[model samples]
Target: MEITDLTPAELRVWRAFPLNEGVDLRESADDDPADGASWGPGRTVRAEVLRALLLDGPTTGGRVPGLKLTGARVTGRLDLMYGTVDPAMRLRSCHFEKPPNLYGAQVRALVLSDSVLPGLTAGTLRVGIVLRMTGCRVTGPVRLAGAQLSGALFLDGAVLGVPGARSGRPPGPEREDSGERPEPALQLNHATVGTDVWAVGLTAHGRVRMDGATVGGLVNLDDAELHDPDGLALEAETLSVGTDLRAARLRARGMVNLSGATIPRRLVLSSARLSTPAGQALRASVSTIGELWLRGTAPVQGAVNLRGAQLDLLEAAPEVWPERVRIDGLTYRRLSPHLPAERRLPLLEREETGHLPYAYEQLATAYRAAGDEVGARTVQLAKLRRHRRTLPPYARLWGYVQDVTVGYGFRPMRAAGWLLVLLLTGTLAFARERPRPLKADEAPDFNPVFYTLDLLLPIIGFGQEAAFAPRGVHQWLAYLLIVTGWILATTTAAGVTRALSRQ
Candidate 1:
């Protein structure tokens, strides 16, 4: 590039690139390039000059090459598609006239901290070092699809997809509509990052997608706000992470999808306030995580679908529980707070979704593993009651009888109580009237207590029932005693057998 063709700012950048020296044009630290209209020709650097320097600029003998500039206006398109740049590029506190296109390009390090860009298009770009965009304000989508980064990808305190208020520049096109479907504000689909993804305090107006992306280290999104009212706010389906996916204190306005993802470590969402009315708030179905933490004060407005999810531990708070949830095939080895079965039973009692007998059984198993026999029994009894609601009228009637008499085999003491009550009633009734002896020579002594015992115990013979014959009301009383005894004994046996099978 000719020296006459470059502006004063571009000349400075050109002189500093080979020696890795930084060029700051701002008179003061507070002088931002947001008001690019105020910048004269001296502060304007053509994008062609930058591309020229990156591709075939003069090289220093041994000094490291870099392009570090601050507080300038970048004009025209800085298109470096499919090119390989060796220098580290750091453009802090700068304003871009157009979005830099680095599609399929390979670079060393790229840092654009506290800068204002219309958008970014770095799809399939490969970075040898870090890609930091902390405190940046972008007005459109930041596409990084299929990008391979050897170091961390930082977006801490960055704001994207918002209109340019102070810059007076028109915001980038919100969507590149193709086949009627809009693209996401931040797309990292199928990207591979060697280290962590630090996105703390990130605010995006549209969906932030990371579908099928793989990260070697943790992905932290603490205190982030994602708003996509018409669609998903954060769609991370099949996102595999090596460490924890921590998103504590996150506020999302649409559904967050994590279906089919495999996070071997913890998936923490503590203190997240999610709202997606008429849709699911957090749909993590068919995912596998080491642990899932949802214990916080924030409320979730929509249903949570955890069907077919496998977790080692599910640590949740009752206050943050969603009103409706589908946990049909959710298998968690443990639950948090060690709450009683009664307190947790409501989770499985979503009658509008029909009976969840398997869910109740899972809860029972969890309680039993924790050595809470009473809690396990409580869960089992609840399961039976819920199942009874789905039975036919006659079957339900019989179920009611089993429930009242013995708690559907869960309350063994009820059977004993019934037996005591019947024994007392029969003894008192028989004592009031005595039956005549059938034969004076062969009959035993007329003992009312022994006679009542003989009539009530169907399997045993006390020699009193056969020896005496009762008449009138007393005869009818004997018949009633025999029938009642059989009913109680049979019910008690059936209940005991059922309870034993559960154990």
Candidate 2:
């Protein structure tokens, strides 16, 4: 059909392609009635090209085969507004030279796989369709705000040049109720991909804001250089990756805010350097970085804030500490057995510090939690010694003696010293009991004093029974005096020892 015989709908479809079979532009060129209309030079020509292609069927296959527009320069903007291509399409090395409007185009399958849009620019490149660009270059800012991408959006080795001049418009009002307006089920905002989505060297020069984006698959940014001042390199909230978020060497000058993001699988940020400010480096709150493996030291100038985040460190092998440390509210099912002794000590010593007693109590609590009863007791004893001066006189003396005795249980030398004192006292008593040399001729008189001494000796040997032995009439009085002396001497000695220890 000639272009002049076509209707507006047919012309619109025809504008998306070049000249094709069974369509003649020359015949309809002379007397076109729409000439005086608001049509631009490029739009009119593009329409004619698309018309010819629509009338022609696939050269071989039953389906519409892929369209190749390599190195083709169109004078006007190409509008593929809602066009659908049944097969893969390629615009390799094409130069739009003007804004190509693809507002809501739905490329049914792959579109622009490994193509170049160098001089080609666009106000808004709508890639909301299930588009896949394995390696495509965009020379201007591309907007895929509400686009739904099924397969990977591969920007492998693709460089997006600086954005064009800003247009005049009041800034879009910020959403007050951000939560009310649900974050994109999957939003990859301001990301600059230099390599394939799975490439080893993908880089983003501009701000790569994936804020509120949900990724159903792994968002592999391995060896990607992301530079943004606000420092929101990847702002994923409730992001779910099926596998690891492998970002080895994922250098970010801005903050990698994964606040409130959820990763059911591992979040491996090993060797990833985050050079944000002190407090705003890696903010992940109430989120989960499952099995976080941070192997190499990724110097983060900012705090690795994981305020209420839960980290599963079970997979962190003992051979080496993780390259990245999660300082959030971490929960460990079990620590690595091969963890360095130096690393283990700090974790064990993180007791809540405050007053001396409270600090010691916390230490005891931590020790108990770690199944170290002996350590807990040691902490308790240390605390007691530190606060001994504050205790009452009696309590002070008791605490002192207990400290010497019970605390010495673990010290053999101190225990032996106390035992030696007891042994010496027993030996002296035994030696005094041995038959002593007394001048037999000068035998002691059978006086009251002599009888008393005899009775006292037996009582000391066999207890108070001998003291109660029958005497003339004052036997009860004598027995009382003997019993009083024995009780007084034993109690006095004990009191003196306890009192002297305190001094």
Which candidate's lDDT is highest? 1
Model 1 spans > 4 angstroms off: 163-181, 435-457, 467-481
For candidate 1, lDDT tens digit of each residue in 5-27?
87777889999999999999877
Off by over 4 Å in 2: 1-61, 73-76, 81-87, 98-103, 113-130, 161-199, 314-328, 334-337, 340-503
Model 2 Cα displacement at 200 (Å)? 4.0
Each model's TM-score, in the order given?
A: 0.92, 0.54
lDDT of 2 by residue, 1-503 (tens): 56676455345434433322122222233322223233333233342353235324234434344454433333445556555534444544433444454544555443453444432221123333345544455444444544555555665555443332221121132111333222111125433222224534555544554655555566777777766544555666555555567777778776777877767677777777877764466767677767665666354666565555766553333323322334434443333333333334332233222124544555455555567666655665565676776788997886676566445132224434544444344334333343222444444332333334443332343222322233333445446445544533443445446435534
**What's the number of clashes in each of the models?**
0, 19
C-alpha-based local distance difference test score of model 2:
0.47
Q: Global CA lDDT of candidate 1, please?
A: 0.85
